[model samples]
Target chain A: MLRLQSVRKHYDTFDLDCSLEVKPGMITGFIGANGAGKSTTFKAILNLIRIDGGEITVFGKPHTQITAKDREMIGVVLSDSGFSGYLTVNDVAAVMRQMYPLFDRADFMERCRQFGIPEKKKIKEFSTGMRAKLKLIAAMSHGARLLVLDEPTSGLDVAAREELLALLQDYLEEQEERSVLISSHISGDLEKFCDDIYMISDGKTILHEETGVLLDEYGILKVDETQYHALDQTYFKWRRKESFGYSVLTDQRSFYLENYPDVVTEKSGIDDILLMAIKGERL
Target chain B: MRGMLVKDFRLLLMQKQFFVVIVAVSVFMIASGQNTSFIVTYCTAMGMFFSVSSIAYDEFENGYAFLFTLPVSRRGYVAEKYLFGILCTGITWLLSVVCCGIYEQIVRPASDPAEQVLITAISGLVLFVPLAVMIPFRLKFGADRGRIVMMIVTALLFGLIFLVAKAADSFPVLKQAVRAVNGLSGPALSGVAFVFAVLAMGISAFVSIHIVEKKQF
Candidate 1:
């Protein structure tokens, strides 16, 4: 449903050069650290910031060519952006109901209640988690076909985050055409719901693969000194030394298992992959 | 477009200054006992300032980003601002004229000069064209910087007008040209001036929209 073709943006200190495509009915998790070009990519797609090169298309039309009606199909949630501090949650709901044609007033109010956001309380008075919930309510209540969220769960507590995720899952089950591109530093949240994961660092995408496939393809190997020395250099991503052995990350887990049956093998997580990738020790 | 307008109006309603200004204008009109023409001119000037301040508020509040994300185009956003300014000026002018007419009816009880009132209101509305043209440019730039630029431009224009008037007093050719221009009176002059003012405003709105469209949020 969305395509970013050879996108390149340059600044004095950073350069973002990546290409990505998001298909319908899939949740694409954009994982990156702060200043890792995740927000920059989102802004580029929304045209909030001008692009230095390449093109972005949504629903088969270039972003520039898409009319206002085309925009109605997409909902965006910036990390800390929304109504001014002076406005209340109800005020935001009223404004959004007019701003979006498909905005569901009943759903918005119900979500606000469910999220424990006071309807009449000023936004400035609300906690950070409540504010984030208000933005989520606005974005989801619009019946948008595509959701582009930047750290939507950042400020939420455990319960609020779980509720928000459940709400998203419900929305996903209701419509097969709906999709989401969520960027977050928290791997656990994405792990729970994301179908595909895209790991970006230093302004470039390091990996893009299905979550389950990634889990199957990469393994962490715990080896004794003898086995570690005998292992080929190409198979190890990085090694952490213990008193008796070293732990290594390898793509060819079966080969390692066959070679050394006594050595331990464990599934790798997103955080572990990101650490290895950032250290330039990918296997 | 209607949605944009409604949202803007709602936000504007939240601003206490708008209501304060309305009350202050109403009280000042009551106290000054001014002529209808003066009231019309005063209201137009106030409306211009109000519109400029509204634009500044929108920027300061980060309202543009939210508005842009909605189903509103850059062109529509610019157009609606200009339209709202025009509508505000029109409403203020109408209210001033009506209040003055009622006052005059109570004070004079016999005079019926509808044509004169209409002419004065139209002329006051025409004067707003230059203001409308200048305020959007102010908004495109930083509002504070735009205000400084506006002040400098206004000073320069006044100085130029004074120099031209002094020169015309001494120069026979310039005096003749001034006299020739002033010879046309009544509705004909007013009509021509109004047309030129509208054309200028249209050009300004188009230019402002182009500038805004090219701007990155």
Candidate 2:
């Protein structure tokens, strides 16, 4: 379990103010556009970079109080960085064996083999997909209870992404109280994997709800200019202008459908939700 | 700390060909009866740069951001660097000593004075290495920035020496102090140098740890 409470890190042009939680046995996803503070929140959570203000806790321990032994249960994968590119799979295995007292070498090697990674080949020569897989392999093989993955699905093919999601599912099924906090640009993957999704924009959480609730309740109502002029804006989350009408995004699909009997209400996808949240004006 | 050291070792492993080239050059020098002390010095210097290279490698693509995400603490990272510097320097010194020793036995017998100087240099490596590495690390100077910082440091040293020389010329006590240092016996001078080097290295390690603590990443 992980909790970030009002975490804030300052920058000249960008700032991160995040608060979220990864409950036990749940996969929580942070969805954002580029520079939406996803990676910054991850860094602050891990204490890789210091925060200006706020608290981060893992397994009920503050980040400061968390010891190396405690970190044994935390596994991480970063999109911008990883194991040194010059190292081979075997060399990384050796490093991991030294790093984690309970490192499963056989399991690691077997996963590498299954992933089609060459033991002798340096990671620098590995393809983008291979490197991503290698990172996942390292994270998953260590029996970590908390997996914090930033852009874990990047550079992976569609099938590979599905396989990775399945692996994560199996991991949770195998262990009780396991938690994962993953960030990705790919909304579909997040839609498929996350129990709860948080939409971030301009360094703030604009939307947070269960995936099923979002899909079942959230809708876009398309009305012509004349109809839009008569519709109440308070009922919608945000409305985007179209050539002939306005498409209103709202979580209360029944309200719009019941109130405006002629308005077209369609189930909103994650992509549409993100776009409206980011680009549409606030009420 | 052990994990970080292993990572550095694996980084150096990437340069296996570079080590081969070093071996080839050393052999050519010994066979040609060239000054092999240069080789030893080169190898020692290589060790220093190699340690620096490891730090630079760690910073490559902001890799430390990921590395610290693991269990290792910042103090642990700094401690690991110091140990790795000593290890690399010691290994290079031992390799050079063995090769140079073989050359002495088979080709040119090492003179007493020359051997003594070589022994001193080899032993000084332990003190020299950590200082060399710690300062660069404290400054957080990457490989390219290291050269620039080195130039700036050299200029500052030159300026300090110039001011001291002027003071010595102007003041009788300064001249006397210089003479007193020059008049020390060999053993006493060696003792002074050893003590100074140890003190400097101790300060370097302390300062480097402070720098790491102050650092955000």
Candidate 3:
């Protein structure tokens, strides 16, 4: 549903060149450290910030050409921005009612009630978890075809995060054509939720892999200097120097498991993959 | 646009206490026999400020980013603010006029209520001049810095006005021009002010749209 091809944005201190794709009915997770250009990528896709070069298309049209009507199908949850803090939930609902013809106000309020979001209190007065919930609710309430979520689970508790992920799963299950592009610091959330994952670092996309491949095939292979020298290096993606010898990241975990039985093969999660991708040296 | 209007109006309602204070102060001043024209202008100016302040609220805590993420275009956002500004300022102008008219009848029966209403109505148009200028300033510099910039600009404006008055006092050509302006009939003067106000608002809105369109977030 969305594609960004080498989208470029330049700032005084940072420059971004990113490429990503979210296919229909798929959930794509974006993982990066702070200031790694995840939010910039999201903003570029939304056309909130002007890109220096490259092209972004949403729903088969250039992002710049997407009209307000087209945006009605795009649900967005920004990390540090939201409805004006002065507005209450009721006020936001009233505004949403006008903005989206398909906005499910009843569903929105029911979700709010389910989450214990008070309808009368100013959003600024809401707790961080409550505010996060409200943003999620708003994004999910409208019958959007795609959701561009930046840190949607940032302030929520563990249970709340699980609840939100479950809700997202429900949202996707309800519509076979729907898609989501989400970024979060919490790798576990992405691991449990995303169909595919993109790893970004220093404003560039460093890795993109299906979540199952990343988890099932990718691994950290710990080896002393003797074993490292003896083992075949064919599948090693990255290697980092360690006190004992080296920590090698391999994409062919089973190959190592079957061939090099003595080597320690630890299954790599999203966090482990991100660490290796960022800190390890290519072999 | 309608969604944006609802958001801005809802934001303005957060300061319901300010509305009460404005009304209470206006009523108190009118009851104490203060100049009705000043009261009307005071209420009108105060009410118009809410529209300008809505810009600040939209910008608070990085709210503008999310606002644009909604189904709002840059031009539509600017249009909504202008429309809301007119709606807010017009309502207050009407309310102040009614209050002043009532006060004129009950407390100052000797005063020409019709003339007072006319002067107050014209002042409403003049009031739009500042609203016109403030929107672009606020949009360009943001809220806190915009307020500081506005104070400096207001000082410069007053200085310019004083200089013009001094020149009018000394130069016959300038003095005659000033006298001509002062001599125009009430309706004629209001009509001119209306045109000037509309011109200023159009330029201000244009500049504001440019500011927003060029903004990164």
TM values, all candidates: 0.89, 0.90, 0.97
Report the C-alpha lDDT of model 2 over B58-104, residue by residue, as the tens digit.
87777888888777887778778777877887688777877776666
> What is the DockQ ranking, best to worst?
3, 2, 1
Q: Which has the greatest DockQ? A: 3
Q: Which 10 successive residues of model 2 chain A have the least lDDT summed?
A: A228-237
Candidate 3's C-alpha runs over 4 A off are B109-113
Model 2 alpha-carbon drift over 4 Å, by segment: A225-235, A258-260, B28-39, B101-123, B126-130, B133-139, B158-191
Candidate 1 stretches with Cα past 4 Å from truth are A84-86, A122-125, A221-229, A233-248, A252-258, A261-266, B110-112, B167-183
Please tell me which predicted candidate would have the highest lDDT against the true structure.
3
In order, the interface RMSDs are 2.1, 1.2, 0.6
| C-alpha lDDT score of every prediction, in listed order | 0.78, 0.82, 0.93
DockQ of 1: 0.46
TM-score top scorer: 3
Superposition error at B110 for model 1 (Å): 4.9
Candidate 2 CAPRI level: medium
Cα misplacement distance, residue B59 of candidate 1 (Å): 2.0
